[model samples]
Target chain A: MRALCWNGVNDLRVETVADPAILNPKDVILKVRLSTTCGSDLHLIDGLIPTMREGDVLGHEFMGEIVDVGREVTKVKRGDRVVVPSFIACGQCWYCQHDLYSLCDTSHPKPELQEPLLGYPTAGIYAYSHAFGGYAGSHAEYVRVPFADTDCFVVPDGLADEDALFISDAAPTGFMGADFCNIQRGDLVAVWGCGGVGLMAQQGAMILGAERVIAIDQYPERLAKAEAFGAIPLDFTKVDVIDALKELTGGRGPDACIDAVGMEAAGTGLQHAYDRVKQALYMETDRGTALRQAMLAVRKGGTLSILGVYGLMDKFPLGLLMNKGVTVRTAQQHGQAYVPRLLEHALRGELTPAALATHRFSLEDSPTGYHMFKHKEDGCVRAVFAP
Target chain B: MNPVQSDNAIKAAARASVTIGRPADELRTLWLDPGTQSRIWTHFAEVNPLDGRTAEWLARGPAGGEYRWRSEAVEVGPDEIRWSSLDGADVPNTGQLIFRPAPGDRGTELHLEVRFDPPGGVIGEAVSKLFHIVPGEIVRHALYKFRALALTGEIPTTDPQPAARKGGADR
Candidate 1:
């Protein structure tokens, strides 16, 4: 089977590897149809998230057709088109029972490795680093879905593979971000970044009843996409974002602020430079420029929803957050909880993530796809791979 | 009179706690179940319930050997269980498991404390440390595994399986 393997930092190759098979009684094998690049994969490729080994497969957000099912897999069957969430979960776990699927305890096969670093192990994720689970990713010709009855969601009729692929990851992450905000009538929501996740978050906020959603980014194409999604686009390069947000919100700030830009955020001033230097030196794992701005631009006593991935940030404004009575909510996406709702939204034509699929490639051209996605070349929001 | 300090008379202790998202009674039942205990405490080679309040167990020792011990429950309650080794153990040990309600509506806070007298005392402790057999680490791992099992119904491990092997491209 041909799959993309990460050999080292900035090095990705298409290699023939063994095909995936059902490992557990509740597992299913999927012949991948569409797997797309995510902003988080850029972090992996840049060597920010540790514990990645050579020959490790690299992809997470995908949708495919079930090729086989294990003995206990009852909900899905061979020939069923499905979209599995990035985070693997056992439906029976306490966390999963509580809809906190990202924190599922029984998914990460190697809990001992993460217990020391994260205080407790998180749920296993497909094609993430070994620290997460070492589970094979969906970029290959075939991928395994564990706890299939719980994790695999059959795509509804009339939804194409492109529309359903982002629902597996980016859409759910964005919807989860908006859901965390608990938006009320006529509330203004601000989202940082205009990548696929950020754009979805902006749309999610609008769908969740935010009167207006402001999308922030330096990229013209992304900001344009956000505007196309009915969000007010704010280019950080042209204007002072904090002041602009304040003026736009009439001095109270947006009722909720979302940071979709994760560890590799770009910024203008000395603090951004410091963060960059620290990240380069391995002293920190995140550049918190966008996060800091979002924290500052949020209304007092309002919600700050962080969809961005962060490891550690120096000079975090916990004091400011405390004094302002802000509510901070963040997590890796619990896609299992949101997929059903997202599918409904997609079916209703309220959510169309297909536009985010700006480029498509064959499995053999995955390296180039990743290269284009990494450099944001040719206005590529995401490079979708059809295996 | 000062007692002579023997080379084989060293005492070590470890304390670790995890807040499991389950009721105290539920956690206690799971902990007291021998089948669940053996599965969660993977270091235990065997654990046979001798009676309602006692168990004979074989723990994995340094260099792949097994150490035998018999533990009798000293105190048992709805929220806590205390036990100690009876006699004829290679390294005498005593342990207590306690459960308390977490603040708010969270769950139970499971606390564990274990103390053992090393076979060769200070030298035994040093040798165990050299062999990467720190008692504190062992207790910590057990406590974590216990929490995971109680909350997730299984201890998570990343050991490769046949279906998910990380094979080279050349293969």
Candidate 2:
């Protein structure tokens, strides 16, 4: 089986590795149909997160065909086309029962590695790091998924493969972020960054009945996609984003703000430069331009819905948030909670996530695809790989 | 607490616990079967019952060596079991397993404790470590698998999966 493996920082290669087999009674081996590059994968490729081992297959978002099923799997079977979320959930833990599937206790095989950092371990995610339970990822000819009946959602008939792929990560993540806003009628939502998750967040706010959605970014292609989705676009490179947002909202900030730009956020000026230098020196891992802007642009008593991933940040504006009574919500995507609704939305033509896949490649060419995605070359929002 | 104990006089002990979503009696039934218990924690050791009161155990030390021991069941109850090594054992140890009802209907609380002493004082401790006689690690690994097996019917694992080793042929 050919898979994309991370050899070192900024080094990826296509390698022939032994195929995966069922390691548990509830496991299923899927022949991957489509796997896409996520913005978060950039962290691993850059060695910023710093836990990835050499030769670890790298990818999480994918849709596939189940070619083998373990003995204990009941609800799912071989030959089913399914979309699996990035997070591996057992569906029987306390957290899974409460719809916080990412916090499932029994799924993470290695908990001691994470206990010191988080005080408790989270549910394992595929191909992230050993701390996250070094499960083999889907960027291969075949990948094994455990607790198959609970983790694999069968794709509906007539839903194209491309359409179901984003439901694995991007679409449900954005939808979960929008849901955290608790949007009211006539509410206005401001979303920072126009990458795949950001664009999906913009669409989700619109679907959840926000009167207006403001998309913020410097990239023209991404901002244009947000505009195509009927959002009012703001180019941060050109305008004073906080003031522009205030002007657009009649002196009151948006009811809710979403930061989809995470640790590797790109920006301009002294603050971003400071973040860059510090990040390079391994002092702080996250560049907070998009997050800080979102914090400043949200209204008093408004919600700050963070879809972004961050470690520790130096200037978090905790005092301003506290004084203004801002409500903050953040998590790694609990995709299991939102995938069913997202699939229904895709079936109804309400979501067109396939537009996010701007580049495509064969499994053997995935290293080149990742290079383009990391550099955002050719305005690529996502690079999809076909095995 | 007395702080003036002599060096190497204290026994080394490790304890671990887990809450399983099954009744105590139900867990006790499955745990009493040597074959089922060994299968649940086969990564730590393999136990073969020699008779009604004794079992032969072959276990791997943490440092990748092998050791053999024979244990006799000293006491047994509906909710607890106690075992001790027989005479002339390569590694002598005592172990106890207790199952109690967890509060608020979450099911049974499974507790395990193992105790042993290094053979030659402080030097024995170092050689014991070098020989990989790590009873603490075995207890932890076994309890973790026991909970996984009792709840999910299979232990979680990432074994035999593909990883590109550095300097390997493929990479």
Best by lDDT: 2
How would you encode candidate 1's per-residue C-alpha lDDT over A10-67 as one tens digit per residue? 8888887776666567788899999999987876786655667777888999999998
Clashing residue pairs, backbone N/CA/C < 3 A, model 2: none
Docking model 2 quality class: acceptable
For residues A343-378, what per-residue lDDT tens digits would candidate 2 score against the true structure?
998898888899899999999999899889988899
> Model 2 over residues B1-171: C-alpha lDDT tens digits?
444334333336667787777888878777776655666556556788777668888766675677678889899898899999987766677889998888986788889987664455423354347445444556766776676666677777887787777332221
DockQ of candidate 2? 0.44
- List native contact recovery per candidate, as a fraction of 1: 0.27, 0.53
